[model samples]
Target: MAQREVIVGSRVGLHARPAALFVKTVSAQPVKMTIRKGDGAPVDARSILRVLALGAKHGDTVVLEADGEGAEEALDAVATVVAEDHDDPA
Candidate 1:
C-alpha cells in the first residue's frame, strides 16, 4: 500500500465539477483507494458523494491511500488532480 497527504488548493475546494473530476480520476485507477481528512474516517476515493461528504475545504489537508499493483501511481494521479485544482490548461 502507498499513501500520500495533499492539501486542496482550489479556491472553491473540491465541489461540483472538481469533485466529479477527482472521482473520475481516482476511479479510473485499478487500485483500491481511500481519502481521509482531519482525522475523519476514510472514504472510497471512487465515490463522489463520499469524497464530498468528507467536507474537505480549501487548504484542508487530505490523506490518500491505495493498495494493489498500481497503488503508487494511483495516489500520484490523485495528488496531481488535487494539487492542480483539477484544472487542465490544455
Candidate 2:
C-alpha cells in the first residue's frame, strides 16, 4: 500500500467541480485509491459522491492511500490533484 498526506489547495475544497476532477483523475488510474479527512475512514477516491461527502475545506489535510499495481504513481497523481487550486484559472 502507498499513502501520502496532502493539504487541499482548491478554493472550494473537494466539492462539485473540484471533487469531480479529483474523482475523474483517480478513476483513470490502474489502482485502488482511497481518501480520508483527518482520522475518518477512507472513502473511494474514484467516487465523486464519496469524495464530496468528505466536506473537506481549503487547506484541510487529507490522506490518500492506494494499493496494487502502480499504487505509488496513482497516489501521487491524486495527491497532486487535491493539492491544486482548481478554482484558479489553469
Candidate 3:
C-alpha cells in the first residue's frame, strides 16, 4: 500500500467544487484510493458524499492511501489536487 499526507489548500476547503474535482481525480486513477481527515478513518476517495462528510477545511491535513499497482501515481495525483487552491483566481 501507498500513503501520503497533504494539506487542503482550497480557501473554503474540500467542499462543493473542490470536493467534486478531488473526487473526479481520484476516480480517474488506475487504483482505488482512500482519504481521511488527519488520523480519522479512511473514506472512499471517489465518493463526493463521503469526502464532503469529512468536513476537511482549509489547511487541514488529510491522509491518502492506496494499494496495488500505480498506487504511488494515484497518491501523487490526488495529493496535488488536495494541495491546490481551488478558490484561487490565478
TM-score of each: 0.90, 0.94, 0.96
Clash pairs, model 2 backbone = none
* lDDT of all predictions: 0.85, 0.90, 0.94
Best by TM-score: 3
Model 2 RMSD vs true structure: 1.3
lDDT of 2 by residue, 1-90 (tens): 789999999998888888999989998999888899999999888888788889999999999998888998888888888898878775
CA RMSD per model (angstroms) = 2.2, 1.3, 0.9
Residues 1-90 of candidate 3 have per-residue lDDT tens digits of 789989999999999999999999998999988999987999999999999999999999999999999999889989999999978776
Cand. 3 TM to true fold: 0.96
Candidate 1 whole-model C-alpha lDDT, 0 to 1: 0.85
The ten-residue window of minimal lDDT in model 3 covers 81-90
Q: Order the candidate numbers by lDDT, best to worst.
A: 3, 2, 1
Error in Å for residue 90 of model 3: 5.9
